[model samples]
Target: MARPVTNAAFEALLKAAGYGNAHAAFARQLNHAGRGHGTWRYDAASVYWWLRGRRPAEHVQATMTDVIGRKLGRPVAAAELGFTIAQVPATISYPTSAGHAFGAAEQLWAMLAKQLTPASSETFQSDVALQAALAWRYDLPDETVSRSRRQPVTAGDIQSLYALADHFTNLDRRHGGGSPRARALMADFLVRQLAPMLHGTYTDAVGRELMRAAATLSGQFAFMSYDAGDHRIAQHHLTIALRLAKAADDRLYGAHLLANLATQAVYLGHAQEATRLAEAAIDGAGRVPAGVRARLYTTAASAYGRLGEGRACQSALAKAERALDRATPDAGPRWVNYFSPAHFAGTALKCLSDLHLYRRALRHAPDAITLAGQNARTRALHTALIATTHARAGDIDTACGWGRELARHVADVHSARVNHRVRELTAALTPHQAMPQVNELLLALAATPPPE
Candidate 1:
């Protein structure tokens, strides 16, 4: 038998929020708030879906919270409005201190390693993300915890963990995050090598450093999970990473984590949320190096472009350029090292491309291609963008040329995100398949090996 609709919670919430007819109120609020992305049909009938326990999109949930909170003259959380925190796994709870955060992360990693927890299908939970962002913005859990351990920890062990984190990050960047085998290997290392170190004692200073390293590793795990299309698991890991970063008092890295979440928002097509998250990232990023600021600005620019805010996007791009100009070779940390001249150009190209400014995008493409260096995955992305611009401009020959160039690296780069661009290039050429070059491009893409 089908489960009956549960309207009690929503009905009560609506009553508390002072809405007489929720059907009309929801439609009016959503329209006024500009929550719909041209496709959301927010009308009286749509409210029925919520009453039936059918969840809306992440942005709608956020907008609903905002709208109701305004009417109630207070901050309204999603939980009070009947939205469960789906991003949090059953294995862990919110942590309050560095030691607590580290312990929770270790427990979760062990569960994942042992397959004690089932994989979740929930993708994006805006409420959870919002809570995390707010926590990161407001709470800097700097509580001092004694690092006395069963066995004394050494600097060598900490160095080793850092090296492992760096290695995995580079591997993910080069080969993409879709490899189950790679994820398993990293998890095993975390369980066997890093977990014990966290439990063993050290001084307060060393404990903070250890937490920071673990945060980096955890953030990488989260990103890999995201790249592999495991959004729920990614959210769990990301939450853990943010807490650990706060515990360690690493503001710059905390900003990076927010930017990572913002990137996921953009990828998931939540332009408004992406913009908000990116803004939060910038706000929390205090006194960072110019390179780091540039990177954050790049994220904001991407979000603005997605929203079709040309002026805002251009302003952000300008800020990124100025920041890049101010950056010195030895200025930023290793995490921000990837934001090189090529990276700067690539980000600007993407912003332009997202805004449908192909003329500007094409002008910037060659420089990005030239400086993309040995990063085949990045090169493939830049090449595909060039192909897309030509295709959009009705220049079939030029488009096919760039497509052929992109296909050369498509098979070599094991990144699904990059492959998405390749797919876009192929789609752009679909109408011209009668041309020999276009047909060849399609065949090449079709024959490319699946991500391992």
Candidate 2:
């Protein structure tokens, strides 16, 4: 019997078109939503409809066309897809390109604009897709030009590329990691120098590691942009990152990438798929170092928590904690440094909090708060946790007090997670909004806007 036309068959077609391998390409295509949302349980048939001009929720048009074009052996145009699909009313407002690639790219760019408020459930899937696309771009060997007439490798290029990554990395750390300007520059750099760098002259192992590092960094940029709500761009970047990581043959990064993808799926309510992705990551990265392996387990635990699998959640958390005990600070990658005691406390507490074990959540809050150090983002998160838990526990006064504290902290900075937490707590404290302290704090927060 003829083989069924599966995602695998579709992917094979993509490779024939000079794209990266299937998962890498699909991962790249999903990159339109940022890596986290890449494995989103897509409306496969609905995507076929998108080619007929119906706009589906954020990033669907781009993702569908990008993938469909590869699969169908034709130019799959978003304009030809579901632009009129009533179910996808969310992403219809923004413009699209005249055709597939351009329209997709335009949609990607529009998604990256931090200023654009999402229409509905779309969130920032576009940025992720865009970022994924770029991250995997270096894996496309034919795309890298090696003209004999090209100028000698310039010191300026190297300095610029590394500096750009470092600059955005720093800003994202302090400002909460999303930056379109950085995403654009990084995308351009990947298309330009990075692809060529992989092609130029490294040994097999060196090339693999070099591409691996680039992939990891690209995914970071993708995540930052995704956090900023540019789902289209962020997704694209992560897709690209995964593609490159696969090409680099770093099993750990690929699995790690899937862990993030699983987390996104859970957050977006795709519990079944999230569990699968998380499981894939943990199993795939089994050969990774103990420390890296721990991080993977932690990611899986969180996904399990989201799905209300309490036993699975606790088990994963235990593994994560054990990994933490075995870890040597100097052994892990610099990127994983943020996965420290404070981060552990925060994520583990969140798992507890999500499961509605409010007391357990509360117990960890103090640890999180204490270990959170001077990072304002960390502080704001812990404070929000305290405020919300208190509110949930009917401790009105304490909730209001913590709400007031968060109000002051968020006055000078903008973080969606922070903003979301503050909003949640603020809503929880609303019954006591008339209380003098709560009223005063709200007024104070409203009086000042940070310098843009």
Candidate 3:
């Protein structure tokens, strides 16, 4: 075999961080940073391997960057340590101008719809998401989104975009984000109809409204991509949505996008980055509406739970509950409509489940199920959560019963996220396969088809 390439940059950074070839010292810092999550147990040997170009997992790399940055009293990006991130397409980069951003978004939609390249197998990178959040938080607001073109846009045209956004949102809620009809319809509308409208002439006020509408549509596409397991595509679309929100000068909406990114991070197991993004949204959102505040805090609680910080997790959950109590049903923006009591309970169940508070988690199940209303995806996920909690609590028969219910729900939905939860349930119950009901549930789950 050929020799592994050396990571000279990483070695140099280690010295700059005052480790000075003391690999064990650096490893100790990493272990400290990763304490609550699980065992890092890294030693000099691990650092030596990394320097010899055995790249660590994405989450470990993120932790390494954090440890080194703290040591050197500066921000250290993954790139600075000789880690190569997957190249982001040019169209996915931060926007330089209103027209440029719109054009880039159009091209991105085409790329996503056409599948010009194979989907990436790489996991989500926390650093990339964090950097995008920071950019949105600090970047100067656009002076004007006004543009002159052959076609002129009107207020009525902007309203139509909003209507289309609502239509797509409803379709996604009913059919799930992995629905082929929803994906195709959204792509077609964005490319053939919305793209030209974005390029059309409009006043500054109209332009901002248009950008806001675009942001909403882009966010919907992001969630759809996420549900279909196209994580890289989801991150790209989410970043674009954040930029559009910035261009519209809507700080609360920008915070909302950051919260979404945090949720994605937590789903992908990047607990540290999720916490940072959630806190950034909460801190930067100067006196947000109660619903928005509740969402951000709930996101933080989920991240904290993932990290096994039960105390911090419970504190955040309490804050979210208080904020929810203060929120009126129709008070916040259109996006905040999703942050109802049922939705809050669902997230709380997830946080509590992660911390192994299984009984507490199950107590929220009824509210989550009954109040989920018409959202098939939410109902399926919460069902899976309930089943998984039972399995983890050593109640195989009860777990199997819930598993059968999940199997029924899974059959009707086409979501990778729901499928993933089913897989987790399967893993938890596999050892109980001697039981007939558990075996039957496993067979059912095994036969479930991949989402289109």
Global lDDT of each candidate: 0.75, 0.56, 0.80
lDDT of 1 by residue, 1-452 (tens): 54455766766767788764666666667656853433233455445545655444444566778887887899877666674332235443346666556556655564455342333443577667777888888975677644653345677778888899989987876777767778777875675467656656677788778878888999999988877777777777787888888877888998989888888878778778888988999999978899999999989998898888999999999998899899987788778887777777887888888888888877777678875355667788788888888898788899888888877777666665776787788888898899888898889878877755
For model 1, where is the 10-residue window of minimal lDDT? 84-93
Worst lDDT 10-window in candidate 2: 92-101
Displacement of residue 85 (Cα, Å) in model 3 is 23
> Residue 367 lDDT in model 2?
71
lDDT of 3 at 344: 84
Candidate 1 Cα misplacement greater than 4 A, ranges: 1-94, 114-122, 371-373
lDDT of 2 by residue, 1-452 (tens): 43333244333444555553333444345444533432233222222222333233434445556665765678865555424323212331211111222223323333333223342243434334333423332233322222221123333444454566666666665656433455555444443344334323344555455555566666776666555554544445455556656656666676767677666666566666667777767766656666776778888877888888999999998998898888877686555666666667777877887798878877777677664334666677778878888788777777777777777776544455666676677677777778787777666655646424
lDDT (Cα, 0-100) at 288 in candidate 1: 85
Superposed on all Cα atoms, the candidates' RMSDs to the truth, in angstroms, are: 16.9, 12.7, 17.7
Candidate number that wins on TM-score, 1 or 2: 1
Clashing pairs in 3: none
Q: TM-score of every model?
A: 0.76, 0.64, 0.78
> Can you write out model 3's per-residue Cα lDDT over 391-430, one digit (the tens) per residue?
9989888888888888777777788789889889999999
Which runs of model 2 end up more than 4 angstroms from their true locations?
Answer: 1-164, 178-203, 370-374, 444-451
Prediction 3 TM-score vs. true:
0.78
Q: Of the candidates numbered 1 and 2, which has the greater lDDT value?
A: 1
